[model samples]
Target: MISLRRQPMPSTRVLATRTNRKTRKPMQFRGASIAFTLILPVFLIAASAATQTGEEGSIELVDPKVLRVCADPRDLPFSNEAGEGFENKIAALLAQKLGKTLAYDYYPGATGFVRNTLNAHRCDLIIGMPQGDDIVQGTNPYYRTTYALVSKQGSGLETIDSLEDPRLKAKRIGIVAGTPPATNLAVNGLLGNIKSYPLVVDTRFDSPTSAMMEDLEGDRIDVAILWGPIAGYLAKHAKTPVKVTPLVKETSGPRMIYRIGMGVRHSDQEWKRLLNKLIAENQTEITHILAIYGVPLLDENNALLTQ
Candidate 1:
């Protein structure tokens, strides 16, 4: 989930912010080390051959020295211009490893995120992207998470894990119109009974979770289903007490859980390899960062932070 954090004012990407979660599939690939285990030598050669990687020549290096990052200046949880997010921290770590200065190309994370930055050569990397994202050459996944079920702390629904919870049939729930959770709600015969929020939730102005929390606080809904990381973060600041739990065991076709990673230009083979190495080397540090942000992580067994 991408939360856009602004420097002065604040904006949030809500993670799956740029991703159409309802339609996009979870990223699947071998472990980080396995991703490049067979090509370590290839990477060594590429590294010696050139300091940069991407489509043939036609390059405009960002000073040919700094680790230029492409990111939304206001997105939080992921990145921001002020270098305040986890992605920013990871970028700093990468720069240290590369012996390069850290820089950024500020751009709103939307349809043009890649085009205006990484593709334009204004920056060399995007700190967060879904693995297997066709828009860019993504590194091996560093983390995996999922949507969550959120509700008032004292509400009888606090322990509810699935939409099939018996209580939901008679209560109003909040869900984003097109998110995967909505499908779960629909299949469980609750779609017609809940409030639907817009998918493009902007944290600076308003967000799906924020709006749902409002209704929740107002006693307008019984529960709110949101992406786990966003709900976990927002739930803490909510006016009323709330409970957040990963919806990992939800029975659904197309998995609700997704793995996230950093991305480079599609043709940047060497860049991709280097990032995989960074992720493999710093998985613990990255987990600490996400934990600080209240991101709820799940293991392959659907165990909490199961890594």
Candidate 2:
């Protein structure tokens, strides 16, 4: 989890994107304000072309020949240097639809991700961002997802869906600290027997989701609550059968679901519109790619779109 903050639940972090340049020293996290160090590297599918700029206040803020994306190079199930994440696939799809070469500005999706990459003019697009993210303008949402509870088969915990289920009171749970689900656990008094993983880490070395899943598989933790994409993808690929129950029934705290969209510079309305069109026209293919990666897709009404 690179700690890409989402609004509404301001402390909620989205897991996504990059590769080893240098791992930053751990920074102190206080309240909801987090300070972090970032790694910088650019991956280009073609040589850099002249910036296609317009007069001041123009909406043309991108390079015409390349769809330059800001992405994390090591975070899998989302993105990685090998172009294996769902975001990477979607970026490639958009680039092809736009007749532009795909390029990437790789950086850890840590605190300064948008500030250093997209805002710095190093790239023009971010493949995945929570809708309504304040730092960058967001296009129309491409997919909706929710937090999910993951448990190994035969654990008898698969039947538990709501956080308010009484059987959960006696089981140990694993969760990423500071996520919206943490608040739900707190309100339900389930934090008492929980293991809290860090919200931010260098993806090159640390994977909170993988560690949590390992614990759950080993019976060290009875269940793990994680973001839908990560939980669903990993469970689908895990060695043994696993059950993923989307937590759509949370009646308190921040809502468990989110809409994800592409991000662009605030001034680049043209770029945003172009992306929205791409999303609309190729939505079927996009959904297919997500399904291949095991993302739990949802419709606007929070209903499941895929099994």
Best by lDDT: 2
Model 1 alpha-carbon drift over 4 Å, by segment:
1-64, 201-204
Model 2 agreement with the true structure over 211-248: per-residue lDDT tens digits? 99988888899999888888988898787789988888
RMSD of each: 10.1, 8.3
lDDT of 2: 0.77
Model 1 C-alpha lDDT per residue in residues 1-307, reported as the tens digit of each score: 3332221000112224432111122235558687688788886776555655443322324365788888776655566667776788888888887788988877666555677678877788888776556777778988887778888877778788877678889989888776677777877888778899776555556656567889988999888877776777777678988888777766653456777778788767656777788789988888887888878887777778742
Worst 10 residues of 1 by lDDT: 5-14
* Cα lDDT, all candidates: 0.70, 0.77
Backbone clashes, each candidate: 17, 4
| Estimated TM-score for each candidate | 0.77, 0.83
